[model samples]
Target: MTKEKFKSLMQEAGIKSKKELAELMGLHYGTINNWGNTQGYPTYLNNYFHFIIKAKKYDEALKKGFDESEKPQECPSNVEALSLENARLREECEKYEALKRALKEALR
Candidate 1:
């Protein structure tokens, strides 16, 4: 693969830098540095493009969890939930009061 494509794959697979990638692969930093200078990767990393795609898919899945999407859905916490319930109840109480007043007026 081209050097840029190789670097892009590394990033897409979550290795943000050459040093980090080396740490992940248990290799010396100079090895990766040399590969960059030569504009090529070792066969191992060169063969890794497909694995990068898989890694990206796995990473996305892990981040999504059971929600099954790239971004997390915002769920209300207990306090927010109680606040929403309180507002709903207050609206219902107002409706009940309005109905009671209308009934009294009709009985008059």
Candidate 2:
């Protein structure tokens, strides 16, 4: 990948900048530029990319959990309220998966 495209991927992963990527990858800042411009970049980052993708998935799931928790609802009975909450949580999980797919497509 071109340096710009690599940088863009990092940005889409919420990396923000080369320095941030370096920090996350535990590499020297200069190494990011080298990888960005070189053929070996993908090879070097292959395992790391897997982790990054997993992390993104985890983040989406966490956000969904939080969104579900934030919603306010009322039910006539405690059991009914618990059931409603469970359904909302399930819907949020699905939404999170959808959001991740959309993000992946947009980055591509």
Error of 1 at 87 (Å): 44
List of clashing residue pairs for candidate 2: none
**How high is each candidate's TM-score?**
0.50, 0.50
Which ten contiguous residues of candidate 2 have the minimum total lDDT? 68-77
Summarize candidate 1's per-residue lDDT along 31-65 as a digit string, tens digits: 87888576566777766656877978987777666
Residue 58 C-alpha lDDT in model 2: 98
- Tell me the deviation in Å of residue 34 in model 2: 2.0
Give the runs in model 1 whose Cα sits over 4 Å from its true position.
62-65, 68-108
